[model samples]
Target: MAGRIKDHLSIDCNDEGAYYVEARVNHPLREFLNHTDSSYVSQLLPAGATWTATTAGGYIAMIQVTTFACGGISLGAFLSHIIFDGPAATTFISSWAALTRKCGEEAGSPNFDASFVFPQSVAYPREATLSALFSPFLKKGICRSMRIVFDALAIDLLKVKTASSSVRDPTRVEVVSALLCKCIMATFKAKSGIQKSTLITHAVNLRQRAVPQFSKHSMGNFLCMAAALVRANKTGLDNLVCHLRKAIRKIDIDLITALQGDGGWLKYCECIKEIGKASHGTNDKIDLIVFSSWCNMGVYEIDFGWGKPTWVACAPKTKSKIEMVNMIFLMDSKMGNGIEAWVYLEEQHMAMLEQNQELLAFGILEQSPLNLIVS
Candidate 1:
């Protein structure tokens, strides 16, 4: 019933090297679907971290569609970030979902033209390079995560509080990213040698931002990083949101084009390396936070003929989700208009942040409710 999806994906990644497929029979769907610790991750996942692919088949991509005893279906896919970015992955998932709906030729085509526009001529050692950028803040630390859900009312109130007459309205992403950064930093304020500056890096969509623009169906890594640095005594996250708003707006097509031009990668890398290193993590350190917004990517819109997902959660594996310290993902709330912040922090940091009254005021903490499955 998953018409042309297998073929669609293969063609999408054809130039990336050999692709392999795998199918596995796993646990029943209800156990995974109904499981929970206050939220979804704890309920659905078995103990310890499990890879999206475990068959030891050297496949660049792996996918599975499992039918539940209750007549519901679950679709899972795994892809290395080196080959795809958030937008690219979203396009693929949406396309796959549309196909299953039998949306036909109108079910549509994806544009893998991102790479043709932004060539990967630079041989970036993906993991190593990222670790270098993430290390000072996250390396060798035990990371912990918990789901924090903001209700529609809290989100609306925050939008009002975060806005200023001086600055344009703060976006949902800017508001939430600012909130997490400020709250997390406040948790560490008493620590010795803590820096007063904070940096926020956001993953941006290049489809509409690219010159002349690319279709929403455009695939591959059409992504770039935008960093906002909050320096010394940034009174409130609301204030920081203004700075962040400006930084994100600066990421236009001219910038993307230049970053992709001749010697573009080198210049781009250098600017970023400096951004990470220049803070001079000396005795006085700077606080850094990275966030990506998946709020409107239509993850919950996925329906494999068993009704829309009751809940949509990122794959919160230890290696993939928790290992990246101080990283935050802002996604659409299962509830109508709010946002869910999947916060990954050092255990020590999480403890304090969880108790922050200011945060508690605006964001309700939803610890996963535990569930036992008879697997």
Candidate 2:
């Protein structure tokens, strides 16, 4: 009976972000077997877990099981980016810890009915429509091989330097994004040797699309991105920041209102088609696609009566070729405030990033902890 799977449940924190937990028998590697009870499992979570909290949007956390030298007990949890975005994932993990401690409970029972919480039925159009929008761009084939790199201290330093500049506040998400955007733009320009107007499309979430007090806990992809134009000749960091801010701001209430109405989804599709047409098969119009470094891997609160996790990271399988740089942040260690970024890019562009090392710095991890542990 113990070996049988009991629950495969996903819970939304009080903040309305989603997380999943699964219980399984502990493997033979556990050393402290038969010593700890379920309550001990709960205590181990807060002590050993760490999270990379994002500033952009949702609550995201990555939980890792470092030492599982206990009984045959294990649990897993996942915080999806669609529901909590990035910022909310972090808040959910911290809040879950607080809630668990306050109740003096061992893994609080989760409210896991996605029908009521996410409600895929009434949320939007059918799956076909959503699939049409998200279908991978395979017409030309994936162009570049991707590699992920992380340089915690180096990225932080860049943030500090960019913040000191007069153009924009030195916030972690914005400044880092701006820097990465510039890096990619430079790489494309240097490699392709074509200088035309280009744009960096920033994916913006539309959670407050129609509903003002829209519950952050809603589980779905209520998100969209706006392209911030950058001239091929623009070289300065401030210019990138200014255009990014403007592009982000442009996707305001009017844009959301226009997109969410009846048949709005189709209109949105047409808009993308139009842009694709405008690009005219040239890298001039929108050369780079960039998103903030954020993901929610429920690391801190997933306690399955084992010791806390020692390492956690994003899955390496998640690769991109639309742009040279795609980044996501992870917690440095348990009980640490610093974050490490995993950047995916092509080898050629990566060399350029290294050449301009003063502007950007990164180190490749041996392997992605997420892929290692989860898969």
> How do the residues 1-375 of candidate 1 rate in per-residue lDDT, one tens digit apiece?
121122212223334443333333356555554544333344333333233222222344546554556555555566545345666676677776778778745444667565566565646544324334444444435777777877667777778888886565777777777777878888777454454777778878877787778777776656666777787687486787887877788888678778775556665666567666744567646667778888787777766556777666665544334347777888786554678788877778888898889899988676332221121
For candidate 2, lDDT tens digit of each residue in 92-205?
544465465564353323322323423333334443243334332112222332233334464566555655345546444455566666666677678878655654655565
Best-fitting candidate, measured by TM-score? 1
Which segments of candidate 2 are over 4 A away from where they belong? 1-128, 134-160, 163-167, 208-211, 270-286, 295-311, 318-339, 359-375
Cα TM-score of candidate 1: 0.79
How much is 246 displaced in model 2, in angstroms? Answer: 1.9
Task: Give the Å shift of residue 113 in candidate 2.
Answer: 11
Clashing pairs in 1: 35-43, 36-43, 37-368, 37-369, 37-370, 38-368, 38-369, 39-368, 195-285
Cα lDDT, all candidates: 0.63, 0.45
- Candidate 1 regions exceeding 4 Å error are 1-58, 64-69, 120-138, 191-195, 318-322, 367-375
- Which number leads on lDDT? 1
